[model samples]
Structures are given as structure tokens and as C-alpha cells.
Target: MNKLSGHHHISMLTKNGKRNNDFYTKILGLRRVKKTVNQDSPSMYHLFYGDLTGAAGTELTFFEMPVAGRTVRGTNAITRIGLLVPSYASLQYWKERFQQEEVKHSDITTYAGRDALFFEDHEGLRMVLLNHHGHEVPAHWQSWDGNEIPEEHRILGMGTVEITVRYLQRTVNLLKNLFGYTVVTESEKEAVLQSIAGEVFGEIVVKELEGPSEKPGRGSIHHLALRVASVEDLQEWDAKIKEQGFDSTGVVDRYYFQSLYFRDRNGILFEMATDGPGFTVDSAVEDLGKKLDLPPFLEEKRAEIEAILEPLE
Candidate 1:
């Protein structure tokens, strides 16, 4: 049986790479693990932020689009991203911190049966910080050397990602019948599905709404990448997707990890990515995100790429 783990990395679009870097690293207290360009679009910046070494599930990435417009909210989308925090107290700390930073946010509240605090980035990317409730996600707290965030109160990693579609049952059916996930909670309009890998980090919430597809722009989530065990696992899934007659981007080498992309019946794009040959492949753990790095395929165009891109720092 193939093992599809939790999150690999959730990719979104950002208009200003510099401000996005400042918010995620300094404000949210995540480390910039990689600074590279999008492989498909070499001139655009691809920035990654995560815990210490940029673990697979911990990575939150952005592709910079300099002239992108605002996202028009609607259904048939990956609506909200969830970040895991250590405790209830950590939520309070972040609540105060966000207020001080003038970030848009909401009061502490309950979401999907966990204490969660909803917030948004400058460009209106929706997010929530959920209390992990002693979940054993490998978030390295002592990794920050000069950072001022308290050791005990730091964001762990991503939690449940919410997907809103017109037909929740079709999406739920795809996750269950195709991906082998179990429903944790279910209702007429919303349902939370838990991955077989088993953790809040690997789960997804599906909501049904009668509306049009989301008009995506800056601050819009491009896709959600689920974690798979290895390159071999991805190949098996690639074959399975073909066997099922679903449209897919067959197994592709991403340099860091191998992956395959396919849209579910609901039209939400999901990538199954491997967990190894991580960000540390190009740079040392301590030196990660300190400088621009590119894969071998894109190495020859570094000078040209750098010339066209705006400085992130």
C-alpha cells in the first residue's frame, strides 16, 4: 500500500516578496528556509518559510507575482490555511503580538473542535492558529538563535487546511474513495476528513457552498501539496491516477522532492510530494534562506534571473 503522509508544503501567491518575507519570518516567527525562483517561471521569486530546517509539512511557500490583483472570495477553493501553536497561552501571545503589529485578526475562538484564532496577512490570505493540544509534530522550538519569540510559545506547523467546494460530497468522496481518508466529523454542509497518516496536520475540512469558482490573485492559494513517503510512492500514485482516468501531471522531479499534480472531482489542485532531499540539499541548515539558491537545471540562468527579479530583502 502506498503511504500518503501529511502536508508537503502549501503554496500561495504573494505580490510583494519583501513584505511577505518580513511578515512570515519576523511577525509569525518562522525561519526563511529557502529563497529561490519558481521552476516554471524563472523570473518570479519562490520563497519558503518554516521551522528550523524547513521540514516537509512545516513549509509555507509563496510565488511572487509583482502585478497580481486582489483575490475575489468565493467557493471551490482552498480557503483557509491553519498554523499549529503549542498551547492556549500561545494563542494569547499571538493575539497580542498581532495586535501590536497591526495585523488583521480575530479573537480566540473554536474551530473544528480546537481552539483557533483566525487571522489574515496584508494581502488577505486567510489563516488560523490552532492550539495543537499536545500533538507530537516535530517543531523545533530552540532553533531560533537571535529571534525574540519565547521558547515555549512558537507556531508549530500547519494544521487542517479548509477546502470550500460546490459539492462537498463529491470532494469528500474523492478523498475517501481515492485517498483512503476517514471522516472525523461530518454534517450536511461541512466535514473534516483525517488522513490515514493520522494527525491534525494531515487533515482537511471540506465545506459546501453554492457559488462560482474563486477568482484567484495575490494572496490566493495556488494549491495544497500533500506529503507522500518517497519517489516510488509518487510513481505508484501517478499510475493510479491514470488508471482512474483522472487528469494529472504524472510524476515530475521538483529537484528537492519528486511530485505529481492532479485535480480532484471538485477541481482543487493537489500535489503528492515526497519528504526527502529537502531544502538542506543546496545549503546547510544554518545557512538556509540566507542567500538565493537554484536547482541545477536553473543554475545557468541565475544571472539573468537575478537581474529580472526584485530583491526580497
Candidate 2:
């Protein structure tokens, strides 16, 4: 009965690596923590963006699939992503910045009794800026003076993940029974779940929608990963998943962190990953995201991989 922590990271799809790189690192102000290839598919790029060191719960990642078409939005998908800012005033700062940069965004409004502003990335990726005003959650933000925005108003970390499912209760049950989340709020159409850690990052919004399954492509979220304390916790969770009649990828040695993956009843991919041996394993902290990084298993094929992939910079 190992309880899962909050969000580790949310991985999405992007069509243009260079544009994705610019939008996140340059426009959004999140540091490009890692530049690497997708382990399962070396032909594609896997880019990670986060706070100074790409802490566990702060990552917002992308997999570049140049040929990927537009995402066909529908049910049973991770719909909207929420990014946390230091305070309610940060929303105003971002709103003004978005206007200046011509970033598509909505007027500041309240969602679930919190001040929030909605915006879209270059690829129509839906995002919301939520206030972390009174959450007691310390944001893992360290600033470099060169960013377009100031240090106090920097985008902190991932706040919440919203998932839309055809069968709501099944997904809700998985969150409660398997993941050990407590439902904090609920209505006819949605429910908000909080993890044991009880912070802004631990919140999840589950919405019930009746529609066709999502046809994923560019801007579509691929999976949502939750944090596990250690490899021992992951192994225990792996057994629990199988015992309950769910198929899992077991323990995978992702060079940075070990991961176990399984889909929910709604087909939303959920991953349990450990926090150790992070982005600095192969590259120095200062040199991270500066060059192409490959794990030892893929080192031999680096030349072949590099030749096929265009320069992401």
C-alpha cells in the first residue's frame, strides 16, 4: 500500500523541435533542462523544461514528432495543463507579458475559487496560470537574470493536470484506490483529487465528457507521471498493478529515473517514476540541455540517431 506522490512530470507532443524549444525556454521562461532523444524511439526528440535543476514535480516535457498532425480533441484525454505562479499578482504579470508577446490568453478570472488565466501555446496547447498564493508549497524556482520575465514572477512548476474521461468514476476510482488520492471537491461533471503530499502540485481535475477518444498528435499530452519514493516503492506498486488485473511495463531503467507505466480504464497513460539520478547524471548542471544526450544503451547508435534528427536548436 505505497501511496503515490504528486505529479512527477507531464509529457506532451510537439511538431517542431526548434519552435518548441523557443516557445518554452525563450517565451515561457522555463529552463530547457534536458535535450535528449526518446528512449523508445530515438528518431524523435525528447525535450524537458523545468525550474533551475528540473526538479521532480516541476517538469513539463515534449516529444518532437515533426510529422505529427494536429490533435483531435475529445474525451478520455489529458485536456488542460495548469502552471503555478508564485502569487495572484504573477497572473497579472503574465497577462501583460502575454499581450506584449502576442501570446493568446484570456482575461483573468476565477476557477475553483482561485484567480486564473487561460492561455494557449504556439501549437494550441491549452494552459492555465493558477495562483499558488496560500498553498504553503515552496516553488522550486531559481532565476537567471537573462530571462524575459523577472525573478519574482517566474513560472514556478506544474500546478495541476486535467483529464477528461468518458467513464468518470472508473478514473476516479483508480486515483482513489490505486493512487491513494483523496477527493477534495466534486460535482456532477468533475472532481478534484489531492495526493498525500497536499500541495498545489498534487491537485488533479477529472472531468466527465461523452465523446470519441482523443486522436493524439501535436500538442497532445502523451502521459502523466506520478512520483514514487524509491525503486522499492515502484516494485511494490508494479506488483499491486498486476494483481489488480492491470497491464504494466514493470520496472524500466530510464537513465535518469526508473519508471513503471500502466494505463487507466480510460486509456490515459499513467507512470510511476523514482526521483533519483536526475538530469545531471550524464551532463553537468551548467551544461545540461546544451548538447544531445544519450543513455549508455543508446550510445553506440548515437551517430546514426544524430544523422537522422535535424538540429533542434
- Candidate 1 residues lying further than 4 Å off, grouped into runs, are 138-146
What residue pairs are clashing in model 1? none
* Predicted model with the maximum TM-score: 1
Taking the tens digit of each residue's C-alpha lDDT, what string does model 1 give over 1-313? 5656777889999999999999998898889999999999998999999888888888899999998999999989999999989899999999999999999999999998899999999999999999997667744322454467887788878899999999999899988888889888899999999785458888899999988899999999999998888788788888887888798889888888888999988889999998878888989988999999999999998899989988876
* RMSD vs true structure, all candidates: 1.5, 1.5
User: What is the Cα-based lDDT of residue 155 in candidate 2?
Assistant: 83
Clashes of 2: 0
Q: What are the lDDT scores of the predictions, listed in order?
A: 0.88, 0.88
Which candidate number maximizes lDDT?
A: 1
User: What is candidate 1's TM-score against the reference?
Assistant: 0.97
Taking all chains together, each candidate's TM-score versus the true structure is: 0.97, 0.96
Report the lDDT tens digits of candidate 2 across residue range 1-313. 5577678999999999999999998889988889999999999999999877788888999999989999999999999989888788899999999999899999999765578999999998999999888455544445445467787788878888899999999899999887789998888889999886466687899999997999999989999999887999899999999998999999999999999999999999998899878998998878878899999999999999999988966
Total clashing pairs for each candidate: 0, 0
Worst 10 residues of 2 by lDDT: 137-146
